[model samples]
Target: MRLLLLPLLFSLFCGSLTAAESVRLTNGEWPPYLGEQLPHKGVASRIVAEAFALQGVEVTWEFHPWARSLQLAERGKRDGSAVWLHSSEREEKFFISDPVVESGYYLFHRKGYSFDWQQIGDLQGRRLVGTRGYDYGAAFQQAEASGQLRVNRVTSDETAFRQLIAGRVDLFPMDKVVGFDMLHQHFSAAERAQLSFHPKPLRSDSLHLLLSREVPGNAELIARFNQGLAQLRESGKVTQYLLEIQQPLSLAP
Candidate 1:
């Protein structure tokens, strides 16, 4: 009994000495990945929280529009934000973490549109809708900029999907899991049946955590987060957590 108590007491003593380190991060509604309503605030949130815990830090989250989340974090109004595709502009502003999640952006389109594409150029001459301010990828941006592809930018994901189903647009690219989750939540069985995503991904992108450089100690914090993340990966919790969040959409009805 004394031997067991000795180990427990030591653990408690060390834990008390290093308690209460916490961070506030801005997040958005990108469900099954990160959302305000999903279990454990969704899987990515759970991984992030657990990673921080491994480093003896705690996390508190604030939900906002994706753009608003970036704005607040960039201004240092929050410590940082989560789950973004990295760009050089972002790298200049924040201390970015190692890959937090594996994400794929597939082009969603209506059935019977006869769509298939092996390259970005294959999308030329097709009408596409994209959510304003979302980054699809460099190839996508270059195609859009050079006029090889024309896209109608909408303000929200629902609008984009609605446009596709209504035949107002030929295609919309979205995260595979997110697109299906949205379909399951917002569309009728028939409406969902009309939409399908091409199996080929626009870009296989890894989402990341961004720690604002404007916030003091965030540089070190990011390092700690990365270390903790590595530990989590080695433990296979990341893979297990992902599978539990589950699967995607196909246009077969």
Candidate 2:
């Protein structure tokens, strides 16, 4: 009876430990999508948190620079990173979760510039700015190589937008939805009035949650996350959550 009781107590302790397990999550300050502010609660953060909660997994969030966050995750310093673009390089370094959101890159310019780019060559002689460390797809890369476009690469979307507004650059690349949200949330009415998004978007990409390769059972964790995400999508909760936090701007006259 004493031996049996000891085994039962150990099993109970293991169960308690599993029940209270938690993981540390990290993300960058990307406004409208992920940021250190209100209302913007970071769309990817919210979705991933909700999904993990359903699995009884608790997470603590740390905010760091985008590059630093990825670095930490890759080095096994953090459990996972949020809102990452899936890429071959990243895949080799981290375990990626199911895509959480779809976003496209668009060209933004001063309101008066004509939006007529039939080909990459059309952008030649025009100054363009884009976020550094982002892949705007192969076409833009080809244009840059051919000297068809003058490119200025900045570290953040806000920096790119500010550069365009300050006349430091002629055009900037941004995600259409995120660009609109930033304009609505951060830009003053006057500043927003001076900016406009081109009708043609440059590239479309999916965003995913990335886990550190060092995390125990990383593949299993990503599989669980994907399963949860699928359920959220099927229930339409994912789209609804996106819309709820997305504040659209009304163009001022």
Best by TM-score: 1
> What is each predicted model's overall lDDT from 0 to 1?
0.90, 0.81
Model 1 Cα lDDT, one tens digit per residue, 87-149 = 899999999999999888899888788988998889999999999988888899999989888
* Cα displacement (Å) at residue 2, model 1: 23
lDDT of 2 by residue, 81-168 (tens): 9988898998898889888988888788988877678567788878888877777779889778677777888877888888888888
Model 1 poorest ten-residue lDDT run: 244-253
Which candidate number has the best lDDT? 1
Off by over 4 Å in 2: 1-18, 154-156, 166-168, 250-253
Between which residue pairs do clashes occur in model 2?
A: none
Q: Which pairs clash inside model 1?
A: none
Candidate RMSDs in Å, in order, are 4.7, 3.4
